[model samples]
Target: MAATRLWIAAAHDPAHRNGGWAFVRAGAGGETLGRAGGDRRTTRARMALAGLLAALEDLPPGEALAVVAPRPDALVLHTLLKPPAEPPAADADLRAALAKALGATTPATRTWTLAVGDPAGPTPAAFAAAWADLASDKAKAGGAFVHSIPRPNLAKVQGL
Candidate 1:
């Protein structure tokens, strides 16, 4: 079977040590997934990895997929796709988890694709929703929330 293609995006607030992320499968009628969270201490990179890991965890084991994320993140992820020069450090645990997630999927094949676009352009709809959730979390004095809803239902919930 062919691999499924997904578009993913994330938002982070360094000062708050929190962020949100979202993903949508390519084409119409795919489900939209999103979540927001934070640690007392965390970096942008860690949050991005956390989002990707969450997406992976949500997938069925051995499901072949081609994950795509916006540019700068794609660059960071590409660096991670390489072997570490030295022993793992701060993000080591997350990286290890990412490895395990990939392992449970397709065997021996690359899985992510990064898209290059005008950063000034409007945020991808998925990312915008993520940002809204992040803001909501901040306002509530709590961290994050998760939801998996069909595209149309998600639209209604978001009041879009």
Candidate 2:
């Protein structure tokens, strides 16, 4: 099964119609497929033409699409992407791991990071569930939703 990672970076304005969305599709290995698009549908068509869309469409069961939208908390996101240790099972371990990963974003997000990373707090059963609430907020809709619209609000917590 193939996995698709799309970064739909567009001009900051929705009404501006800047024309052509710059897309970066991460596929097999480190191979990438980038294309220009006048609109969402056209961008998707280009992806299909490149065969990345078809690869994702044929993904096997249990291998669902993983979609992420850009968050307004640029600083926080910057922190999240920073180098972090390997994920650990315990919340306490996760906290330490996130501190390394998210601490760089901002001092404020650092506090929140420790809060959820606490093993005694909400005992998240898995990595995906740990930031489930935040993921929904970041996407501005449930994960089941096919697409998301960027918004000003950001999820208070994020899972690494």
Candidate 3:
């Protein structure tokens, strides 16, 4: 079997204090495939959006990668491409700009999955659970697992 490359990332909105993580996988077929996530306490909508964007941006060029989110509506993936003006006119405008940018290049057959968690105090179990939820949704969602260990506690937690 061919080796698969998967990229995972988490995002958080400092302002709202909400966030979540996402995982994207690129199979040998050159097709973007995977899911996103959204959770109640552990993962928030905004955080999930950030994680999804981070994952997509990290993907290698020309590599097929799919995104999955627990709450697809919360994340406006397209927004990352064409961000709002330097100083966005307003929150709504900024969001719209982001949406347009993210939606611009998306394929019609894109796949999405939803997961749950807390953006703030995300436990190792929560992260693992969310990853499993999204990966199981798609058969091709398999590859190297990349995760960012939060500072302070991350440094203290052994075997993370």
Candidate with maximal lDDT: 1
Give the winner by lDDT: 1 or 2.
1
> Cα deviation in Å at residue 45, candidate 3?
2.8
Q: After superposition, how far is residue 60 of candidate 3 from its true place, in Å?
A: 2.8
Pairs of colliding residues, candidate 1: none
Candidate with better TM-score, 1 vs 3: 1
Candidate closer to the true structure by TM-score (higher is better), 2 or 3:
3
On the 0 to 100 scale, the lDDT of residue 50 in model 1 is 68
Which scores greater on lDDT, model 1 or model 3?
A: 1
| Cα shift from native, residue 81, model 2 (Å) | 23
Q: For every model shown, what is its TM-score relative to the native structure?
A: 0.66, 0.26, 0.32
- Model 1 compared with the native: what TM-score? 0.66
Candidate 3 lDDT (Cα, whole model)? 0.40
Worst 10 residues of 1 by lDDT: 151-160
Give lDDT per model, in order. 0.55, 0.29, 0.40
Candidate 2, poorest ten consecutive residues by summed lDDT: 110-119
Model 3 ranges with Cα > 4 A deviation: 1-18, 22-43, 71-160
